[model samples]
Target: MAVGRNGRFSGLLVVAGLLAGSWTGFGQEKKSEKVVVAGTPAAAPVPAAPADSVTDGSVTVGGQVIAYRAVAGTLTVGATATQDATIGFDGKTLPDAQVNSPDKDKPEDAPATARIFYTAYFKKDAAAEHRPVTFLYNGGPGSATMWLHMGSFGPKRVAIPDAEHQEGAPYAIVSNESSLLDVTDLVFIDAPGTGFSRIYGKDKEKAFWGTDQDAHAFERFIRRFLSKYDRWNSPKYLFGESYGTPRSAVLSADLQNVDLNGIILLSQILSFDNSVDGPKWNPGVDQAYALALPTYAATAFYHHKLPTQPAALEPFLAEVEQWALGEYMTALLQGSELPEAKRQEIATKLHGYTGLPVAYLLRANLRVAGGVFSKQLQTDEDTTTGRLDSRFKGPDLDPLSGDAEYDPQSQAISSAYTAAINDYMRKQLKYGEQQTYLPGAYSDPSFSWDLRHQAPGGPSATEQEGGTNVMPDLADTMKANPRMKVMLAGGYYDLATPYFEGKFEMHHLQIPQKLQSNISYHYYEAGHMVYVNEAVLKQFHADVAAFIKSTESGK
Candidate 1:
């Protein structure tokens, strides 16, 4: 989800378009957005609330909301440590390390000087010889890192509702059965303004948010965290979701520059443009539709709408690649010069390739937005439900309206999985009693974000043409760090990071074949956060375990 889009209720998040928004859940009309930083929109941002006075306010950490103290902060990146495998950072999610620990008095008056606080999860086991210590964080420029901390990673988690759809479910969140703690000693960091993490008040708005500042502050946090724990020599790894991908990626480079170890990119955003591009910036949706085609057909087949094809998603996408690149791209490039018959032919081909109706394709002027795909592909029953997964359908869609069909839930499976983590932190982790899970802060579910228009250039050109470009840097980073390994995980149904677009983005990456092998790609039947899909996640975990193992050391 882009930045803070998690704030809204996810309808069908397992599926891509099942949820209401795109990129960062801005929803349909805004498909033209340029995702410069994971799902975070560079141009359209969720305005930050005016900074409150940095008083002695406290939020739940270990338990009660005690007093808080403001201080000047310093963050620095440290060099990679070389050591014996005996120093095991516990695989446990650090218990609330908030400022008000029982050991010291909670600073009543804001501190006069700058101070930094660190929280850690510890495991008492002695087999510390060599371990993969992973630092985990979730997306959302404004989100607390708790999603991953409590969800699939932290040794402990939140207790979430069984079904998010169940009416009036107490903000149920719970301990996750699938935490990375089994293999990794995990650490979760809260960005400046969210969660229990706070910044200096006065002229102290500096450490709280945005890309550069965050990377800088987080670098400091890593330094503090490593020094505080004294495990500077452990083999380190980073795992992040949504915006955290960028955070992880940039930090991968940052840490490596300072001699850090490898990085694990979960739901990668190689470049902001590649990640956030809507229709204009990205036509990956069509390819996404293609990758999603068989799944759509299969889901329909399972739902008994389309032909029960024996073919699977891969072969279907293989055919789609041949056509999309040959016919679709050709058609798009033809513009007005293309003849009427060719347009109809392209539309017909697109319908078959995409499971969209030929008439809808033609009527859409040969272009169908992700929203249209969500709403149109349903069976003609007045009971037609559009899918957020876009690959999956729902019970009913407001046919009369021209917006997202199922929302990202029925579409976005991850929303539920990730949301559950929030509850997990409170209930299971037995921590953050005072803090609430800020799902997708920085997002306004009710606020209307205008869909952007074509900027008339290949990609938006910023001052240095540097804003929102991560893929190029990814390419450059790979060049700089020859041993680094990269993996791109995409869901066939993901409209956010369509399977084909991801492939296409990689196709255009400025890297060589040897370096390319350093990068790998995988696909699932789910959407962006395919990790939420039970079946897909099982496989994804297995695959990820293998990938991480290979990168860390030969098994």
Candidate 2:
């Protein structure tokens, strides 16, 4: 999720996070060690945090006791046998290695480039090289995976009463019976400078701070991970959230050498064109308005703001979709050219659908941005709605302000997740690192990101514009691997990455009609983090389980 300039929670993260890149062929032979040339004088050593102690744990699920081991450690990347991978490196073959061990101290002889921290859970009963392994990460470009790690699919989950309410502190974590472990083993990743991941040596932040570079780093990590654990032949899947959705798509396209059985995208934003148009209405395209209308209707319906509320979300959204594409699209296309009579008619309907006053709708010229709708929706109560999940509301200090003071959507869950992950690392997982865990870095310079990405097939301007939009790369990946399957999960209440945007991207993906059936979509009643709501999570768990089984069985 994008942390806004004023510390409010925004839509998809615009800032790019650091991503380490040392691309090497998974099957390539290891290079011989070379002498290290000391660069500048070494800085004084700071004592390392106590080493992570590998631990064993068991949880009972479905009447079965599943034994698992939790391993926490730093995985080294972007380093050559002797020299840093960034030093004297060509574009091709970024000969790199990854060492996932409990010890944090760097070996005197080992090459250190970047250190990535991760917490892994391996099922003891599963066959060594047969069971499926899924790699999970969240998107901020700068966000740690803790949201998905502690709030959703992880074995232990942070329990909050509701997304609309804050949790009382000294909060607690509960065993997630719906954890994906019931079907597949899981690994949660923390990219550089997030959580405990760090960059070493003289390598610049640019190495892992861009799109292609980030994907390449993940590719290196996945390859090295499979090789290290002897799971190269194991069935693989990528589970990514928000920005991680685009990251997953790009990684799927880039890892042509490594076969991925399936991909699960949560709160996906496949294209930036749709995302950038979310909070604000961008001119020249009816796509954004048409897509966002359904979410606006859903949020309005949830708050009972809609003049004519439907009994159910599905029917309400389905009706809104029709109007948004039909009358709404036509009126928006006309702009000022629309007649006063037609404008009044459309404004009335928009008010009915969005709960914004007809006069205000007319004042907006028939387009109400998400933020404006959020603040205006609850103006009577002198509160503002959340961008993440409009179901949540908070009082703005300055009620007269047009914008929301803060995102109640972010505030509603951030504390529970932040507290749960920190406590779990030291208490449950036995990670002894004294380093402060950064859930997200809003102001960190390293989090200042560049979105430009190298196109998959060749140099193309379409790929260059809005570097975060990886729809083309995803389409290319599907074309190359016709058998690769994708399951997209979106929230109807999610204004951040509206469900209709996912629908729009799929329609415009340009994949051959025959291969189109390989992609599937699911919708939830909750917002961006769909799993935060337990009822929705049950459906999420079931859908994921069925998808994993179907893909693994080659169905």
Top TM-score model: 2
Task: Residues 293-342, candidate 1: write the lDDT tens digits.
Answer: 33344334333444334356577567666776676766767667879999
Location of the lowest summed lDDT over 10 successive residues in candidate 1: 78-87
**TM-score for all predictions?**
0.69, 0.86
lDDT (Cα, 0-100) at 143 in candidate 2: 78
Tens digits of per-residue lDDT, candidate 2, 1-555, equal: 456545543443443311122211011112233345678345333234345458898766666678888888765566432333333221122435343321334333223345567788899968968898999998877678888898787788988877567646877798887787878889899876678776544343556755676777787777667866789888899999988988998889878677788999888877665652332423655567678889988998888987877888898788888888888888888877999999999989888888899988888788766667778888999988877777888887578887565678786677777788899998878784567887764445434455667667656533444324688888888888788899999888887778888887887887999887998999988988888888898789889988999897556
Candidate 1 stretches greater than 4 Å from native: 1-7, 10-25, 28-122, 126-129, 156-177, 199-208, 259-261, 272-277, 280-310, 379-388, 391-397, 405-423, 443-462
Candidate 1 TM-score versus the reference: 0.69
